[model samples]
Structure formats: C-alpha cells, structure tokens
Target: MLMIRPSFDTLYEALLTRDPSYEGRAFVCVSSTGIFCRLTCPARKPKPENCTFHETVAECMAAGFRPCKRCRPTMPEASADPVVKPLVEALEKRPGHRWGEPDLVRMGLDPSTVRRAFKRHFGMTFLEMARQRRLQEGFSALADGGKVIDAQITAGFESPSAFREAFAKILGQAPGAFSSKPLLFADWVATPLGPMIAVTDRTQLHLLEFLDRKAFPAEFRKLQTYARGEIGFGRTDVSDQIQAELDRFFSGTGASFETKIALHGTAFTRDVWRELIGIPAGEIRSYSEIARSLGRPQAVRAVARANGANQIALVIPCHRVIGADGSLTGYGGGLWRKQRLIELEQGYRAKG
Candidate 1:
C-alpha cells in the first residue's frame, strides 16, 4: 500500500476536485471547523491552512475532530453504492459457500467490478475475505482443542490439502503440525483503532500488535520462536487479562497494564524498550532522550531502531516516542494511531 503523507494543500485540492480515487483512501480534518470530512464531502471547503489530511477516520477522531454531519465521513461511499449492499448481504447469507468469480457472474455482477468494489471497501477481494472468515471459524474451533480434521470440516474445506494450504497461507503453519501442548496461544482482539493480534502463554504475554502493521509478519515469526510453538488461535487466562487491560487502556479508564510481558531483544534493544515504559502517560520522549536514559546518548539511531522492533503495543508504550524536533515520526501501527494513543493517554493524565 502506498503511504503518502498528505499535506494541507494537497488535501484541499483533492477535496475541491472531489476525487473519487481518494474517496475511501483519504480524509480531511478542518481545524477551524473542528470537523473531519471525507474527500468527497459536499460540505463547504475550509481554508487550505486550516485543513489536514489523514488516511483513516481513527486518526481524525484521535486529533479531537468530529465527523462532518453533511458528508458522514465515517461511512465509506461504496457502502452506500447501489450494488454492494446486496452483494454483501448475499455473501453473509451463504458464508459457507466458496465464493469465486463464477459466483459473482452467476449473480449478474461483473467479476472484475465486484472484485474492485470489495477491495476498495474492505481492502481485500471477496474470495480472500471469505477464506479468512472460514479460517477464523476454524481457529475458534481449534481453541477448544478440536482435532485438525474437525477444524477443516468446520471451515468447509472439501479436501485436506486445500484446507492445509489455506491454513498455512494465513498462519504460516499447517494444522496438524500445530502444537497441542498449549504453551502459548494467539487470538484476535478488536479495538477502536482496528483489530490487533494478541499472543500469550500461561505465564506472560508474548506479542500484541496491530494486524495491519508492516512489521507484523516479523513479529509473528519472532513470537513463534519465543513461544516455541506454531501460532494458533485460542484463549487462556493471560489472554483474558491482556484483553481486559487493553479495554481499560483504550476506554481511557486506566493506564495500568498488569499483563506480564516477555521481551525478546538484544541487550540494547531491551534497554531502550525499558526506558520507553518509564515515560509517564501524557508525556513525550525523543530517541536521543531514550539513549541518554540508557547512559548511551550517542546511540540515538540505535534507540530508534529498537523502538521500531517493539512487538508489544500499548503495554510497551512505544507510541510515546517522537522525533527530536517534536514531530511525529515513523510508527509501525500508523502515525494516526500513535497520535490517538498519545491523545488518549494525555486525556487520562489530565483526568488524574
């Protein structure tokens, strides 16, 4: 996916032009109006200097802006399109069916257009998404220690090979090869920002990361090694603890996270992450400050690299790091989320 930092001028021009290409892909925040609107919003445009563009609605909300009333910016335009609603309803009705191009054509919809529509709205094609839904069910089944074959059957795969292929593609491992000893388990937890994958064993939490983060795969691999097992879906007491803590954290009720975390990093990296947690809520720190805290002021670049390698999100508090100039910098969870997390923590601190 292209990651362009939209400027105020560029966003204003896109809003003026009413670019359909930027419809779901971009959003604009009007500082003067205290509202954020989609690029296609029909509301009166704000001055260029008062406008800010963001990639997601969560970002705008994090920045203390409400959605535009006239544009209803939170809802995607394709959701209001004529054909998509029915198509989505049909898919929901028969989730067990293996959706494909033939199914779309049979429904009197052009396959390519349908595919594009689904991608534009959901970030994945219909078939890929259907497969994901099936796999999610299978993962839930496996949580209860169900047999591999049972999971395949539950997922509606006709053949074992196809089931294995699908399972491997998603979780990086085959079904039968998954460990039964139950060392550490991973499960998806939905958040206001987005869905996050949380992994834990009986003792401590291992990984908690945004599903769409660019470093997700690497984090998964590292977690697999740390847990000494294949990644699979299940829930444990630790998972429940982490989830509850996260709920409180995001709801702005509390910043205290009791989920015991096992850090896998070089000595230097671990040191940097330790200092990251020391940063109080509603406070910001720079890489140089972190390096200095570690008694190695010259290792600013090293500190930044270690911060990027953090697998655990809110628990580790890597979002508190900013550039030396006090500008937001690269964050694997997306800059918008980083901004929101900072704002959320700041609000909590203020309340205290």
Candidate 2:
C-alpha cells in the first residue's frame, strides 16, 4: 500500500480547481459538518484549519467522520455505474475465492472491465480484494489453531506456495513462519452488530477488537511480532473462559469480565487501561479525569492515545472513556457503537 501524505496546500488547490484527477485520490474532512468529502464536492470550501485530507475512505471512516451527503464522498460516480454492480456483488459473496483472469472470463465478464470496475469502486481491483480476503480468513483460521493445510484450503488456495505468497504479501510473513506455540491465539467472534476478534494466551486473555476497526490489523500485527512466531490456533483455557464470560455479557446475564489479560504497552498506557477496567459498568470518565487519576493531569492527550491503542475492547473497558465535555469522543468501533455500549452497560447496571 502506498502511503499518500495529505498536503493541505495541494488538496486545497485541487478543491479550488475542482480537479477531477483528485476525485478518488483525496478527500476533505470538514470540522464544521463533521463529515468528509471528495475533492470534487460542489460545496463551498471551508477554512484550512477546518479541513483535513485522507488517502482512503477507510482512513476517513476510522477518524469518526461521516460521508458528506452533498459530495457523496464515499461512493464515487464510477461506482454507481451499471457495469460494476454485478462484479462487486460477486466479489462480496465469495471473497475467499481465488479469482484470476480465467475465473472472470468463466463468469462471462471481461477481466479488465471487472478490474476497472473494482478500481473505480474500491480503489483496488477485484483480484486485490479477493487476495486480501483470503489472507484475512487464513490469518483468522491460523490464529484459531487451524492446521496449515486447513488454513490453505479455507483460503481457497490450490497450492501451499500460492497461499504462503499471499499471506506473506499481506502480513509480512508466511503461514508456517508464524508462531506454532500454544501461547496467545486470536479468532473472530461474531456479534449482533459486527464481528470482533479475540486473542488469548494460555493463562490470560490479551486482545478483543472489532473486525472493522482500522487499528485492528496493526494491533494484531504487533501482537504477532511480540509472540515471535509462537502464536497459533486452538483456544487456551483462558480463551475458553473469556468466551464464556463474553457469552454472558451479550446474553445480558452479566456485564462482568474476570478474564486475566496479558497487557502489552508502556507503563503509562497500562495504567490508563487499568483505570478503564475500574470504571463501573454504567459509568464513564473524561480523558482529563483519567489522566488526573494517573497523577498526570496534563497528560489527557496521552491518555486518549493510550485509550485508542487499547486492543481489548469491552473487557479492558476502554469504551468507558468520553470527552471532557461529557460528549462521546473517538471510539475505534464507531460512535454509534460507543453510545449503544454505554446504554447496554447502563441497562446491565440498572438490572443489577
């Protein structure tokens, strides 16, 4: 992936020029509207301080901004073109499929047209998306203790070499190169709202994060590196324990988590996360208060960053963090979720 740095001057210039070239490459996040827009948006431009640029829709979404209605920043005009919809739907249906040019031809579609359609819609070709999906599934399976061959088959790779190449391409390592130890393992846990990934070692749980979280991949990579190729599938005793606890949590039987956690962070970060665990089910704390509790009243920003870096969702209690003004702040899982989580916890507390 190419890292495109946001240039305010250049992006503003594009906005001013209404340059079609910048339509898919750049987006403007508006502070006033709490939304982001493509450079080609017809709305009057906002001040520089009120504008932030992003390279991808995922980045904009991760930052807690909505797509502008006027601009329709998220779905470019090309995406809505009739030729693309079928290919997009097919890709979505079997994301794990090993798609090639022949596969497209077999499907009675022109490969180049499909590629162009995907590029226009998602900023990547259908092949690339399929490859990424396969890798993601394989990674999840491996983390859940699936055998190497099983992971390969699950990913729809006909050969081990192809599977390994795809895995290394996305995750920077081959499947077998990852940890085979019984240490900490992670897997996707489907929920009503969305899928969440959970990680656990033999004696304690480690991470639980929503699948859609942009920070999730980076955090999982960090954990994989920390495990030094020792991570593998199959649940640890601790993982099973946490799974049961999570079951209770969702079933409304309880909102309590007693799973041991293997926290990975600096002393200060750990302190902030520990405080999050202490927040009552129905209660919340401002970032400023959390910083003060850590004896660093001025470290509110640092506290917020640590909170953002937290991988263990719900369990570590990072969702309890709010803005200083008692407003909902940044949540990796999305603000709608944060509000719902707070409400759920409040209901749980009330019942208790």
Candidate 3:
C-alpha cells in the first residue's frame, strides 16, 4: 500500500478534515517537526507547505520521521497497549495519589505485572511517572512565589527534608539556597516548536531559550552569577507579558516583541544584540554585513561570537543571521527550528 506520488491535494484535504477513511491508508510527515502521524491525528496541523504524504508507516519511518505520540502510528492500533492504558487512566484519576506497591495490590492489580507493562511500553514504571508529576507541581509552586515549605506540601512531600532532598537531586542545589529578593524567576513556556525556559524579574525579562540547547544550563548558571545569586524559580509580570506576546507571534497575529530586557554582557555584546533587533522580521544579514554596519569590519569574528552568545532567542532575532553564501550557520536552537522560524516569518510577511 506504500504508493509514491499520490495526489497532494486529496491527502492534504484528508489531513485537514481528519478523514477516517484515510486513517490507516495514509500518513502525514511534517518536515518542520520531523514527526509522522495518521491522517486522523488530533494534534494541531502544520501548514500545508510543511507537510508530505506517505502511504505506509514504513515509508514514513524510512524517511526518518518519528511516529507522533498523539496518533501512535507505530502501534497496531491507536488505542495504545491494553495493559498500559488502564494503569495510565488510574494515574490520571489521582495523579497525586502517592502510588505504592500496596495501592496497586488493593486495586486488583499485580505490582510486578503493572511494572513490566509500563516498562515495556513507556520505559518507566507508572509510579515514576506519578512522582515526576508531583515534582513538576512542586516546581510550579516555587515558580509561583510559594515558600519552600509551601512548595514541599504542594508537591505532596510529607516533610521539608524529603522535598529538599528531591529538589536538590534534580537541580544540584537546595531550594532554600536560592535568594528570595531580586528574583530571576524561571518558568517554562510552550510554543509550536517546543518548550522554552523563561527567566525574568518584575522589571525585565532576563533570559529566554529553548530547552534542548546544550549551553542552556550554563547560561542559567551565568545569569545566577551575574544576578549575585538572586535567582529563584517562579514567574513575574514580565514573563506573563512575554507569554502573551509569544502566543500572538506564533499564531501569526503579531510580528514584533515589545518587552524590556535586562541584559548581562559587555559593551560590544550589548551593541551586537541591539543590532540584531534592528533587522526587520523576514529579513536577514551576514556576520560580515553586521560587522560592517557596526563599523567594525575587522571584528567579524567578534560579531560572530556575539551572535552565538545571544541568550534571548526570537526577540533578538538571531536566527536571521546566516552564512555569507546564504546558507544557515550554527544556531543555538536546532537548525530545523531555525529553518521553520524563517519560513514562518516569510509566510507572514508575504501575507502583508
């Protein structure tokens, strides 16, 4: 059933409508996301230009696209495994239930059997998933200005010591070690590309970057040092303001950022960032070009270094900088995301 050169128009229509007739008959691969899904997948559809049709799951996989979690194209059916679904449902019904072996036994479930099923399908025990949920809640509590004790209780930990131990294990520090004043709160914002961390205070956004960037943790440590250890986990008015603006920008209803930024860098680096902001959306420049504009033609290497050191993504528009011959250069965020971003800006600019 793996056919080549199928009508793009017909499959595109099926994808838009979630046509059941095409559920097992076709798949859609999104070049921007590197993901494949059944025609009936319920996730937000990518733009038509980003889509490619495949007649079989094998063909999709051959093209290097991973099966989407929402559609589960690699599975025998979309319902997921029979054993794992009920366990997942139970965890969802009481995500804060504090799971244990005894609780599984009381629910007419076998502890070993449940563990095997979850491990086989999800690569972790159901209890581990629940614990992660608890930890995430604790993290959210801290980010929302809750005290250490309040965060511990909110995360379902029975004692302060236990909560601190868990938090320290993950973040390499005790929660109380971070200062409460002049806080640079860390929070996560989800976009069509992926989750990004936003660090900010009441006055200005301090840092924003994609989670998968190799230098992200280092950047956070640098910020903590620069802020004189005043960095804590949480949100601020600046974060909320940026979140709304990012939503508008991604949805194509807005084209620019207006939030104030508190940058930590030398004079040259700060100047380079300001130059980045001056490039209009959907346009680009080379490092040599930027250096010339800055009247530092001999400092092209410095200009390139400054571009790579940029901490604030999107708002600073670093993705607009490319190689001299019109190819993409190294982007801190993955190159695919950079390509998708350029395409997005170009599409929006074309509409205007």
Most accurate candidate by lDDT: 3
Poorest lDDT segment (10 consecutive residues) of candidate 3? 57-66
What value of lDDT does candidate 1 attain over all alpha carbons? 0.74
So what's the TM-score on candidate 1? Answer: 0.67
Candidate order, TM-score descending: 1, 3, 2
**191-293 per-residue lDDT for model 2 (tens digits):** 4334466777767777888877777768877888888756655556676566567655644556888888888999999999899999988888999999888
Candidate 1 backbone collisions, by pair: none
After aligning candidate 1 to the native by TM-score, how far in Å is the CA of 20 from where it should be? 33
Best by TM-score: 1
Model 1: how far residue 139 lies from native, Å? 2.7
Query: Scored by CA lDDT, what does every candidate get?
Result: 0.74, 0.72, 0.75
TM-scores for the candidates = 0.67, 0.59, 0.64
lDDT score at residue 78, model 1, on the 0-100 scale: 56
lDDT of 1 by residue, 84-118 (tens): 66666665555456677887788888878877876
Model 3: residues with Cα > 4 Å off, grouped in runs: 1-81, 94-135, 147-174
